[model samples]
Target: MSENQTIYAAFAEKLDAVLSALEMEGTLPPETNRANVSVEPPRDPSHGDLATNAAMVLAKQAKSNPRALAEQIVEHLQRDPAITSAEIAGPGFINLRLAPHSWIEELSAIAARGDDYGKSAMGAGTTVNIEYVSANPTGPMHMGHCRGAVVGDALASLLEHAGHKVTREYYVNDAGGQVDTLARSVHLRYREALGEDIGEIPEGMYPGDYLVPVGKAAADEFGDRYVSEPEAEWLPLFRAFAVERMMEVIKSDLATLGIQHDLFSSEAALQAAKKPEAAEAWLREHDLVYDGVLEQPKGKTIEDWEPVELPLFRSTKFGDDQDRPIKKSDGKWTYFGADLAYHMQKAEKADALIDIWGADHAGTVKRIKAAVAALSEGQGTSIPFDVKLVQMVQLLRGGEPVKMSKRSGNFVTIADMVDEVGKDVVRFTMLTRKPEAQMDFDFAKVIEASKDNPVFYVQYAHARIRSILRKAAAEDLAPSDANLDLLAEDDLTLIKQAAQFPREVEAAARAREPHRIAFYLYDLAAAFHAFWNLGNDDAAKRIIVAQSAELSEARLFLAEQIGQVIRNGLAILGVEAVEEL
Candidate 1:
């Protein structure tokens, strides 16, 4: 827990004690529970710093008017030294106005904590596996994958910062029919590299020019050897060559977006291993594996749905809609079977798993969780697996949707998007919205030099601080806080906002929403900008002046604090915070 957490917890304990004392003395009615009481910042500033709903929540059982109960609660709380005053407001809301010294003390605590200010043990060293950017190696990532990549990376960073042992992983699905198609496509490219005509691409094959180079290398390596070979003879070789090139391109593309994974698990390697068989063996030992025929799924009819008995997994035993197939009638494991093994690996390696998947896989959520639960056999019982579906990103340019049809060979790659907007703007805009909500990224709007461009607005705030620091250094003023209390109302408003940085980080981390950090930084930057503009109107409000070097140092100290918060926030999101525009 953090200092803020410690303080709030102590306050809650004291409040609980007060309620217990009242209950024991029979000053309150019976059966009034106090467990749900909470202290949080009020929505309205005039209501005071923190507000509690204790009286309102407990009023019915106490058989007293909420305001009366609030008054009784306030009389007891006002005796505490930490609380300056407690007022019973409308609707029995108990509003607290802490001593100004308390705010100063919080600021001091922040200064003492420094970079560790918002660190928390909320996760308690639990392991969380975050799988993201498992984009098919068919082609380079597009704008849609970019948003998920940034969101996942930022979320992992936030989780780690909040005390979870996080593993950033990328799943490579190289065993699917898509790889077979890629192999054939590369063959055509190899023929083309041999100066063959190789007309239009066949249907159901990759048409992108990206595979041309891979084909050329393959042809150079084994000129006429595979020219007359059968499909089976060349398919595996072609797949290996194509996937290696695809992974290389993917690594470069991810580098452009500043994303690096801790692990890149290959589906083919896992399938080829005896692991899934071992997993099946484990399930068999638990009596969860059997032979059965699955009824055809509704909503879609498979033309080849012949009722044939096959090895099945008792997924419905855990809570799936029905029993699922582990192997097809052809004696090959189905895609879902491979997924079961992957999840089993996750369950064995980590205490918790978080899969960042595309919205298209939303229906797979229940079955995946069910498989993990069934496989664990109630030992690692409540398998806390969460799936985050990152909605699509509509890319726009000049107020019009950018046309990107892959069939036309004009799809936007992540590299192109990052190059157009630059990495900082790309990272910031991608995080400006929650993963659950679809986002719109207007290329024109993001590059604009206005408030609508959150990236520029926030970066400008940091740049302005650097500018002020430059001015301070040129004027030979110290940056330390010799007399930070000299801050005026406007100055202290900015300082107080900065003081909320640690709390904001903790909240954003716990909520698993890094976008909250982005939004908070924008709000903080707006506050600093308003303060900076005020100084432009009145010169005495300037950050640096000729007299009272100690006061100047104090204001500079506040500016440095604001800059540090912005820097840390941007760093978590993997955006660069440059000192100059």
Candidate 2:
């Protein structure tokens, strides 16, 4: 347990004793535990250092007026040495003012823990797998996939900090119809590379010139080897080679943003010619096999729509709107069947699963969850999964939305965005908002060095702390002598803020939202900046030029702790914390 957590626990113990004493005096309920009572800072500082709702929550149960109970509780708490004083205000809130040394001790805790201050073992030894940015292997990643990549990667980091054994995985759709189209697209490029006049790309296929390299590679390997072969003989070899080529480019693009996955599960590998029969047998044994016709979706046009009964999965039994076909009337499995088999494999291998998908897949969440539930025999532990849907990011510049078209081959790739803004700006901007809310990424504002730019604000805080430490060293004060008692007022305020790191990290990790960390770091930086401004007004208040070396050491200790907290928080977001920005 952390020092702050120990302090809270001790406080809870004392509060329980006070409640018991009050009950014996006929002033409150005898059975109140006080265990659920929370000690937190009030948003308004005038209320006091810490406020508790113990009296308020127990008022009706104890059959006493809340304010009266608050007064009695305050009187009991005042006996404790850690609490200097207590006041009751506004309908029974017990506001506490802690001893100055208690705040100093919190600073000592921060100084001791340093960069490892906020790490927690809340997750224990549980294993979790996070799947994200599983974009099809048909082309390079675009801006559409950037946010999910960052969110998933940051979430993985946050979970690791919270002490979980986490695995970051990417599912590659290398066996889908999309890859077939990619093969055809590359075939056109191959002919063009051979000096054949293939004027314009046909409709319903990729038109980007990025695949020209893939075509060249294919020409080098085959050398007209399949020129006279049947489509069945040549198409498989082309599809496999084309997908392999695209994946190389995709990996390079992901690396540009400092993103990497621990595992890449290939769909083709799952449904290989040798493995497909095994999946079919498993589905049959599980009673997921059936023959039923699915109602045509009402709003969208389906080019291959037909009314026919075929092999189906009993998805409706698991809460889907209707049973879905696993195989079409043409005796071939649908994409959903492959996905079902893939999830079954995941369930067999992992304890927990998390999927980060784009918001366009919102309608598919319930069905996927239902399928997993049924597959796991109603034991959610076997296939526990949560889908985090990241809303789209609209690219903008100078306050206007930027537009691009893939058909015209003018679309912006992830590499293009990274090149323009650099990886740090792109990543921090992506994480500044919650995953579920739509965010606008403006090229103009993201690079600006202002408070509005969270990335720079946080990095600047780190740099400022380094500057203070440098000044302390120049004044001949040892950087390591930390007399924590001299830390008071502005210095104490920064230390107390730093102590909130463990709580903040636990909250953010529990919620699976890394944006909370981003916001917390910004607030911490604001507090540091306010303290920095004090140096300009009062020379005595300066951290380095204080009257005694002890005072300087204490202030430098606080400053170094601030830097560590900033570094840890930014590291969780996968952003760099430089000594100088």
Candidate 3:
């Protein structure tokens, strides 16, 4: 099927032409704002198959009453070959009832396109860089980082599906005090591995037992070579070793959930390349940074409150609450300063940037957004930057919370979840709801073969379709040369629901909310399920109609198209559409 064959696309273009014809007739003012004009399904299906607000939007500028303009527009729309009838409903809304043949043609197109049906050109090859799950490489990825990981990866896939060139990236935070602590922790384990009884791990160090293997590996590679050395002699060597090993563990965890990043940008490497200093110099020269003392902080009082001059970015000029300190009094760069440099680098490479962060970073969004805006302004380029803050997820079993704490080393890791529930369950369950909302992942419910579980329900819909196909094959009946026009109103309605997949994909990508796709698939599955159940009450409604092979083939084509949509949607969510429940 050609992309332009989509009913919605055809109608939008048709409406555009109607408006142009109106302008030529002098009924509408020339060059009226058509940006707000939209054609979509009416809220009430009984009202119309499609609705448009073109007349209402251009009425004011056209020096005509909305309802009066709508009546004129309806006249032109009625002449279209696809539109069976057009009526002016309520005020200025034009309700259009499309020909049944038009929808039959749409169903045929969906069947012909199959999995590629919903693919859109919305993104238009725009470069979108998504930085997600840049977890500190101090330990294995835990349940806390699960939501962002799945959400980020799903959003990346979603963007690509919507025709964007997406770069799935991970910003490995291999710098600063966190990695240093990890290095020290590994050194303690190394000593223990070398026959030194380092009893308990000290405070402010990782206590997870996963690092014991790292210690053992280090001991095996360099036996007592770094045991007697000074701290400085072993710190860098241990830091590099620990970071690399922890990243390996992290990578394995991500892979278990089908996540792979294109690039892992490092903070230490960014500093080594002098990006922070270069960004700082640019900001200072632009008068966007200056040495200033901020007023007393609000909300919470600082423990050591003292007025000291420090270099600050004028974040307030770009909508932040106050000027943000980019450098501390001790002459060390703050995280925001380094982030500015990182975003600047991203701005140089991509036309758009997106960051998936934990909700704890909600307070920091304004400053980062301001930084991006400043970078874009200074560079004289338009860089679309957005931050998605994913909220926490609570693990549950039958509605009761499962305890997890990363500090105590007893926290649930991503590997733990994947091991318990399959990766498909983990990925699909994580994306069942919006990331901004807190959700509970119930171990009991996700794998259950009931409608209560969304993943199972959706997969069952696809499986149900496959079941029909198998029955048809056993009967030697193929799903071809069938007249799709033979489908009933309910069957055609089901196909209409399937046709919404492309629209939903674009909406999910444009909003940067991959969870919407999950919800859409759930609804589409439910629609298919309801249509399938119709067969239970009436034998004629089933996909494999033994009495009528042509009808069965038509129904099979419809079922397969629904299955294709479900498969495409699951692909975006990084889940497999199971053929068998």
Candidate 4:
């Protein structure tokens, strides 16, 4: 495994050096900031290999015309042997073209490092705590958590690849009311398991048949002793039992998607340790909490809305809509208060924090961010925090909506979706679109082996390359000794696309969005597929040349590099790279 930094970063650094030299020579004023200068690939490939806005960004401070400044920067940049040509484009933009050898060397770096070719040290081993799929242990993880799980898992993998010390955590909401309801529901099933007809489960109670096994397990463990037991006696024991069993089911479901968190922090455990109360006291000392009376909500208000003096957090100080209550009128901690405590605990050990939540929790992001800011400030440390609100996925089959689960009355499960298409398809399709966008996962379209399906398309690119490489090796023409210089222009284009993997990975990790990698893989795969078809139209563009063993090896080398990129990308996505379709 190696972080052979991409040529892009290398060029950017070289350009920065050039700017520094110009600064020393007084071509630009002393101590002139070059921070805004950017070196990146041009929008049109025909324009150049790399483009820079150095002159445009710095011309004003230097008191020179943009074009003249660009020319001066170009003079210094062209001296770098790898940069074949640099030209001034509209107004002040500089376009650059690198020697084909630069790309060829980059391909060699990729082939040498294999799957770890694009790994980066962007995070520098910072401890990043990502809380995701903290679903209620009340039942099996369903479609609601499916996207968040995949997204979180991919983000964790991305972070690790970028050299972050990542903690994949699931904040179990065991202390919440939903778990108590689950306990009652399981007790009802326990009676049924003991030969009592409990009839229809009551409204507001989880009525899934999935709880039947929990009930039966309880019955088998400790028979009718609980049958005549009081609610107080059985509630706690059943809640514990049901939560454990449901977590088992949830873990099994996550395994089907190849997801396993490193930690499972329980709210009950946090509360038992007095973290919430401690946080409240800490906030009070910091003057972030106050006793306030709130007005009734507009229009249809909360049923129990009443004027009362309760503990409230100054959430509006951090962009929240209004000051939020930290304690209810009954003198109990609000959910927000407990959540703040949980975040405070997380903040103690983390340099950065991320939470993946369902879209319905969108309104809660601001207050939590505010709480984190307050907590970090009190501790005299800056702990960054962000929340990703994943939108709902509309399940479709043959263009018709597939709504509930047959076996359980709750939502369709992650297990069912994984079982239907496949783990790779499930994970990949969940990320084909941005998390904030509502996407329809159509069963028929996703399973189709066509360009329209990104997973299949990307996987097919790798599979096809593998197939060709195997055939080439059968003829004893390996790519190792081939002169990569013999590759066609389009092959170099494909190589350039592959070389961008490191930059893409770094950007994706920095942005905390793994979907960018998914999108990149799809584009690279499309490029590879298009290059393969070029051989169909023109025999000269084919990988295996009849008379030239050297050229055949060169093409094979290109294919190997492309395949490596696809595999590396899929690895970050937590999806398998199939060798054959």
What overall lDDT goes with each candidate model?
A: 0.82, 0.81, 0.88, 0.90
Highest lDDT model number: 4
Highest TM-score, which number? 4
Residue-pair clashes per prediction, in order, are: 0, 0, 0, 0
Q: Tens-digit lDDT track for model 4 on 122-224?
A: 8898999999999999878799899999999999999999999999999989886788999999999999999999989999888998999999999998799
What digit string (tens of lDDT, one per residue) describes model 2 on residues 48-102?
A: 6777888988888788889988888988899989898898878888888877787
Residue pairs that clash (backbone atoms under 3 angstroms), model 4: none
- From the highest lDDT down, the ranking of the candidates is 4, 3, 1, 2
Cα displacement (angstroms), candidate 4, residue 82, comes to 1.7
Native-to-model Cα distance after best TM-score fit, residue 43 in candidate 1, in Å: 1.2
2 or 4, greater by TM-score: 4
Model 4 scores worst on lDDT over the 10 consecutive residues at: 1-10
> Local error of candidate 3 at 154, Å?
1.0
Question: Any idea how many clashes model 2 has?
Answer: 0
Q: What are the runs in model 4 whose C-alpha is more than 4 Å off?
A: 1-3, 300-305
* Candidate 1 clash pair list: none
Instruction: Report each candidate's C-alpha RMSD, comma-separated, in the order given.
Output: 3.4, 3.7, 1.9, 1.8
Candidate 2: clashing pairs of residues: none
Question: Against the true structure, what is each candidate's TM-score?
Answer: 0.90, 0.88, 0.97, 0.97
- TM-score, model 2 to reference: 0.88
- The residue-level lDDT of candidate 3 at 198 comes to 90
